[model samples]
Target: MDWQYENGRIYSTDENGELMCEATFIRKENGEMDIDHTYVNPVLRGQGVAAQMMEVVAEYFRKEQLKTTATCSYANIWLKRHEKLYPDILSEDTSDQAVACKIDGKH
Candidate 1:
């Protein structure tokens, strides 16, 4: 899938030019970014589409040497699952217990 970066979000569209999925981030001071939103079209759920988008976004952060944090539920959950794989790009705030609980589907 092709990804487009605009207005603080990375998104993809379907053949019909419809939005397929997107991940949004807010830039913070000190070279940090908060990934505050992630959405996947219903038909694409459970197909790892969102994960793929986040991976690309994560890579972008790594390339720009930016720190990533998560506030949106999807972003938080994704971070908890993959944070270990991206220690360099992820924010240290992920150590919070709340993120862990969210990863366990408690929130």
Candidate 2:
């Protein structure tokens, strides 16, 4: 699989040019990216590809000194599960409309 970032999305495509996985987000004016969608081709699921894709996006945020918020359920779960790894890049719970994701204290 090959990963590519364009416009405001991160995605991977298969050798035949089929999209295998993707994570999409909205760039908020507050410098926080709101992840709105995350998906992996059924063939690409269960292999941590989604997580890896998100990691790349998170790393970008880290380098750019940005933050991230998740409106997608899958993304929210992943970020909250790996809180410590992204504390600096993950946006804090500020908006009342944001989901209250829980941390498992594993990281």
Candidate 3:
């Protein structure tokens, strides 16, 4: 399976071009991006497809020096598991329910 990123979403496909998984995000007014949705083809569940998508998004955020907010529960949990890689982006207060990411005007 090949995983690819495009249009603020991560997608996976098999050799036959069948969609296996997708993770979507929205760019917020604050120049932050919020991962809002994720879906894995039922047959592809438990195969780490979603994890791969999350990893890609995380790397993109890091490379762009952008903070990320995860509105999707899965993304939230993923972030919790990988806090060290995003310490500067994660909310320090930890009280706000919304996940917010901020970029330093780098876009």
Q: Among these predicted structures, which one has the highest lDDT?
A: 1
Question: How well does each candidate superpose onto the true structure, as a TM-score?
Answer: 0.82, 0.82, 0.77
lDDT of each: 0.78, 0.76, 0.73
**Model 2: ten consecutive residues of lowest lDDT:** 98-107
Candidate 3 C-alpha lDDT tens digits along 1-107:
57687888888888888888877777878777777777788997898877877887787778878777776778878888888867766554322546433333222
Could you tally the backbone clashes for each prediction?
A: 0, 0, 1
Q: Residue by residue across 1-107, what tens digits does model 2's lDDT show?
A: 56798877888887788889887777888767877777788997899888888898888778878788887777887788888898987777523225532233111
Overall local distance difference test of candidate 2 = 0.76
- Two-way TM-score contest, 1 vs 3, winner: 1
- Over 33-103, each residue of candidate 1 has an lDDT whose tens digit, in order, gives 87777778899999989889989988888888888888776777777788778889877775552432222
Q: Which pairs, if any, clash in model 1?
A: none
Which pairs clash in the backbone of model 2? none
Candidate 2, residue 86: Cα displacement in angstroms equals: 0.8
